[model samples]
Target: MHTKKVIIVAQLFISGMMALFMSGVMSVIHMGFTAQWFAQWGPNFLTAWPIAFVASMVVGPIGFAMARIVLRVEDAV
Candidate 1:
C-alpha cells in the first residue's frame, strides 16, 4: 500500500511537472506568434501557470493510469 502510494505520488509529480513545462513552452510560442496581434488581444502572457495547473489537474489521472500500466508491464516482464 505504501509503495503504491509512493508510486502514485511520483507519477502525479512527474505529470504535473511535464504539464507545467509544456504549458510554459506553449505560452512562449503563443506570445511569439501573436506578437503582432497583441495590440488587440493585449499582453496576457502571464496566465500560463493557472492554465498549466488546470491542465495538470485534468491530466493527472490519465498519467497515473499510464504509469500503472507501464509498471504492470515491467513487473510482468
Candidate 2:
C-alpha cells in the first residue's frame, strides 16, 4: 500500500487536472469557444478544484479497492 502522504499528493494532482479539464470541457459544451467561455472556465475550475479534491479523497480508496478486487491484486502482495 502507498503512504498517506503519497496518496494525498497524488489526489491533489489528479483532482486539479480532472477539474481543469472537466470545467473547460463543460464550459465549451455549454457556451462554445467564445470570450465569455474562456473567461468562465477559470472561475469554474477554481470553484471545482476543492470539491473535486474532497470527492476524490472520499472515493479514491473505494475505487482502488474495487479495482484491486477486479484485477485480483492482493493488498498484502
Candidate 3:
C-alpha cells in the first residue's frame, strides 16, 4: 500500500498534469489557437488544478476499490 505522503504527492502530480492538458485543450477548442487561448489556458489551469486535486482525493479511493473488486473477480474466475 502507498503511504499517505506518496498518495498526496501522486495526486498533486496527476492533478496538475491533467489540469494543464485539459485546460489547454478546452481553451483551444473553445477559443481557438490564438493569443486568447494562450491567455485563458494559464488561468484555467490555475483554477482547475485545485478542484482537480480535491476531486481526485475524493474519487481515488473509490476507483481503487472498484478496481480491486474487478481484479479479485477475475482472479476467482
TM-scores for every predicted model: 0.41, 0.94, 0.92
Candidates ranked by lDDT: 2, 3, 1
Give the alpha carbon lDDT tens digit for every residue of 28-61 in model 3: 8888999878888899999999999999999998
C-alpha displacement of 10 in model 3, angstroms? 0.6
* Winner of 1 and 2 under lDDT: 2
Model 2 steric clash total: 0
Q: Model 1, poorest ten-residue lDDT window?
A: 40-49
List, residue by residue over 1-77, the lDDT tens digit for candidate 1: 34657755665666556655665556567666465544423233334445655666678658766998987744332
Q: Over the full model, what C-alpha lDDT does candidate 3 score relative to the true structure?
A: 0.92
Worst 10 residues of 2 by lDDT: 68-77
> Per-residue lDDT for 12 in model 2?
97
RMSD, one per candidate, in order: 6.4, 1.1, 3.6
Q: What is the lDDT of residue 63 in candidate 2?
A: 99
List ranges where model 2 is wrong by over 4 Å.
none
At residue 68, give the lDDT of candidate 3: 82
Q: Give the local distance difference test score of model 1.
A: 0.57
